[model samples]
Target chain A: MRNDGETIELIERLARLVTNEGHAHGLKPAQWEALRYLARANRFSRTPGGLTAYLGLTKGTVSQTLMSLERAGLVEKTANPGDARSVQLGLTEKGRALLPLDGMATIQKAFEALPQPLRATLGDGVAALVTSALAARSGRAFGICHDCRHFAADARGPGQHYCRLLKQPLEDAEAEQICQEQEAA
Target chain B: MRNDGETIELIERLARLVTNEGHAHGLKPAQWEALRYLARANRFSRTPGGLTAYLGLTKGTVSQTLMSLERAGLVEKTANPGDARSVQLGLTEKGRALLPLDGMATIQKAFEALPQPLRATLGDGVAALVTSALAARSGRAFGICHDCRHFAADARGPGQHYCRLLKQPLEDAEAEQICQEQEAA
Candidate 1:
């Protein structure tokens, strides 16, 4: 347990660090996280409720973050065209534009700089921890479209897949986006 | 790069989830982090400025967080006896009592549940990432006392080490706590 305690503390320290990544941009860490999630989410997972689930935060907190992003013109709430009572969230052009400059890139660059073999091992280890944590929390995996059990090879088109759950066609690009409803294949 | 991207995202997602851990206890995740850091910090690392550097956040943000913790009676700020202009932070009895119930326990338990070999690998990976991120930021390592270059194996006492930087003797327990001034031995 002693060694395990050290490991947990290491992870926790890094967790605290990621919260400061958004500081330089004059945005709260949560706001930066929300923007990143919105940009990477699939159409069905771009709602406020989806965000609340993904962040594991209260709806009040999620709503407040969304409101601040809207106030800053980085995110917008739009009425769902298909369901009048529903709402959909989308990043404003500014939001999409700012994604490139996010502190996340700095971290990814650090990853890229690692030796290839170490990077591979590091990826495997991180993926395992993420899996273990999600299982412990009983949370959704929120994985990419192609990784979902509902993805069907329908011959819809080249590099296209169909979502049996949503009954909608998904392109290659969309298949790489994360969805709230994703269940691993 | 694709795998690295996935790994980085996994780490970031876990990071965001960690911020929500303190929600049920009426503490912002950052506040909980501060409490944890203060509790585990060596005497020299338990001040507002030390905390700011440790969290890699602005002093303004750290001061604001400290103010909230003070109002909540979870933390106390006392003027340093050696330096009237400096302040030292300590957790209240209530604060110490609440730590066992902190959301950090859930994640730590998840790490504990892993098989021993996997836990070792996961720890290695996480430690590597933390090191990489800190290097990318050019931040201090903020490691434990025994690992510091200044740890002198003092012959004056058993299981006691002298700190060259602080010019102080450290107990076995204190040598295990994180210190702001620690540099690799």
Candidate 2:
């Protein structure tokens, strides 16, 4: 069996390789991360503050990254309807178009080629590692809505769900998207 | 079975989480990466050019990262005896002492708790993903010396090996370290 040190080493190398791949499309590594987060986050998790928490970066760095993305026409910001003082963020058409063609295509192909059981095992192992690390550091999990403790199922409706904390109905699609307020269920 | 998209998403999330973990220890994400690389890299692979290739970053970015590490007194540079024009990098005592106590301690504990087979499977899957992504992008593998095509085994010695690329004999420990010039055998 491989020792703990080797496992940590492999994880570190994989993380670096994945990040370097994200740098290929005229974006810095951090920019790619922010863009990807915005793409996955639900509407409620689309603010600069959400990004700052999700990326675990300084507010200044996240703001700078957002400004750069806004300048490139890849991301747009609008005043929040509920609170005009705050802003909401979303990817533009160009950003959405670039998502499917990013450097992760190769990684996706590699993952697709793995055996089903191995793929599941890998995912579980990685998820456990992420959960443990974040818990140790008191970092936010930013998990999918369906997995959060606040998720409440609607028994009468086939696909409807609710966020008990937000007091809002969640569509099927939104339930699958990541949320900044997610807590383990 | 999880589909390809889900597999890719898990890996991306894991990568981001792992990278964020490195940001907690008074080092930026990139600085921790560079320092970790220097700690595990062989003597021949400990140069600025090697780091640039291994990290797949521009010369300027790698230089800036190295400068930051130097300023923190975590890394030291000296002229390479084999080639005066190039310099070699090594971690200071302060750096070596910090390596064992980095933010990865929690990650290591998580990895240690995994069943051995699951751990091996996860490592293999990730390595395959990294190798495929790197190959698709024409990036260096930066693999261990023993895995390189240039690795030459000494029939008479029990553990001695040599690197044909560097024309240098490799200690057993050195043969286990990652090399910037590694090409799969």
Candidate 3:
């Protein structure tokens, strides 16, 4: 078991790393989070309220982040059809381009720095653990359809179904719905 | 190297987990980071500028977070003698009391949720990768102090007074000062 101090330290450090990454792209931490959320959204129907809920931030905070995102040409705001006071947030093409594709490069560099034995010992499960922990810490759930490689409809299964990512089963309902982890091209 | 999409998905998941912990503690992620930072600080000082630089937050943002922490009774502010605009941030008794003494219990619970083999591997530094990655991303360096680890003050022979934490001979300056890593506590 790790100490609370240790866990807190790790979390704080992780936050700072993400903050730096955001800064590299000229965005604040909250703004980066808001952009990341938008980039991962599949259908582009995210309500400001939904973003606030997902981020565990206040409406004001979400509004502020969205404003910054808009200024950076990373997000688009549209009036909500169902409600007059609310608005829907969507990602721009620029936002899609900025969604951390180089993150893997960064991770690879970090991985290479580790001792060889440690890298060899880490399996898919360890990667899964990181996902799960990140999910748990971010107020979201991991192991969604997006994370599953088998989630492709073209794969062999009923209705062109099989999750290659998880190499497991993909539920019928999951195939039709968009996951928060899904990123639109 | 892992796919960038996959890594981002995993990180988002981890962020969610940390966010949940933040919510459980009745604080926002930023607020939690502030508390954890204060708890880990061995010595305290004043200046919104310093805290902003340390946390990588904007002045406005740091001021807001400090306001919230102060209102929650988790932190106290004092007049800085030299700088009138700047103030010293200190942990209140309530804040100190809020620090969990035995967070290993929580970590143990998280470990129990995982498989046994995985638990054993964490000790070998797989778990520490998250910290290392964060530090790298933030461009921060950290090393423990020699005095805290009991390095001999009077060692005539070169390389004799080694720090157990650093596992190396400490320079004269390093003996008295702690690095960013230890500051994470």
Candidate 4:
């Protein structure tokens, strides 16, 4: 059996191999992660605090990354209705256009190259480990809004969905996004 | 079954979660990865070129990281007897001592907290994925010297090991370390 230390090292190296990509785009790995999260995160979950938690990074680092994204015209700050002092982030059209060139594409291609059967098993195994890690740290489990306990479907029509926790209506595509406030059903 | 997109995101987030933990230390995630590699690598694998291929990053980034590590007194450069222009890296007293506080330990702990059976499976599965990724990229598969096809047992005595590729004797413990040139037997 492979030792736990060796196992951890394997995980670490895999992480590095994937994360180390995308530097060619002039964006750091952290920035790419932030951009990807911002793209998939719902409007309510697009704040810096939400990103900091989701990325498991310090507020300082997140703040700097956001600043750079803004300077590069890839991200824009919008006023938050809930808090006057806080702002929500959204990707500019330029950001959306550039995502296709993301370094993550390389990893996605690598992942796809795996035998199809192993893909699902590896996914489930990895998701379980993430849950365990969050549980150990008492950290939040960020997940898709559609999967959350608060998600109520058919609020208005067959395709319409609602968030019971936030008491907000979700657009068809938005409901499928990741949310900072997601709670397991 | 979980979709492939979600699976990729899961792997990405888990990587972020574990890698983000060690930022509490002054080192960047890349630096920590480099430090960890240096610690486990055999003397032959301690050069910057070996690290670049192992990391799949550009030589420029690796060079900058090494410079920072040297400035911090964590890594020291030593002359290469075979090639005067090239240098090999060795961890200094400070470098070796600081490893205990590596953010990687946080990941190691999280990996250990996983159910016993799952850990091995996860390790093997991850290893397979990495191998697949490397194959897809035509990248190097850096591994422990002991497992390399070139590894020879009892070349001089029962405890003595030899690296046929380099035609050199390996100390008992060094044979178990990672080698840049390692190949499957």
- Name the candidate that leads on TM-score: 1
How far residue B106's Cα lies from its native spot in candidate 3, in Å, is 7.0
What is candidate 2's TM-score against the reference? 0.87
DockQ ranking from best to worst? 4, 1, 2, 3
Residue A90 displacement in candidate 2 (angstroms): 2.2
Write candidate 4's Cα lDDT for B79-183 as tens digits: 999899889998999999988999767667777777877777787778888887788778888888888899998888987989999999998999889998999
The 10-residue segment of model 3 chain B with minimum total lDDT is B101-110
Q: What ranges in model 3 sit over 4 Å off? A: A1-8, A44-72, A77-90, A100-185, B1-5, B23-28, B44-54, B58-73, B76-90, B101-112, B120-150, B153-185
Query: Against the true structure, what is each candidate's TM-score?
Result: 0.92, 0.87, 0.59, 0.92
Model number with the top lDDT: 4
Error of 3 at A72 (Å): 4.8
What candidate 1 gets wrong by more than 4 Å, as runs, is: none
Docking class of 3: acceptable
Models sorted by TM-score, best on top: 1, 4, 2, 3
| Of candidates 4 and 2, the better by TM-score | 4
Clashes of each: 0, 0, 32, 0
Instruction: Kindly give the stretch of ten consecutive residues in candidate 1 chain B with the minimal lDDT sum.
Output: B15-24
By DockQ, the better pick of 2 and 4 is 4
Q: How would you encode candidate 4's per-residue C-alpha lDDT over A2-106 as one tens digit per residue?
A: 687777887887887777775748989888888898889998889999998887767998999999999999999999987898998999999888888998888
Model-by-model DockQ, in order: 0.61, 0.56, 0.24, 0.63
Candidate 2: lDDT over CA atoms?
A: 0.80
Candidate 4 docking class = medium
Return the lDDT, model 2, position B2: 38
State candidate 3's DockQ. Answer: 0.24
Runs in model 2 deviating more than 4 A are A154-158, B148-160
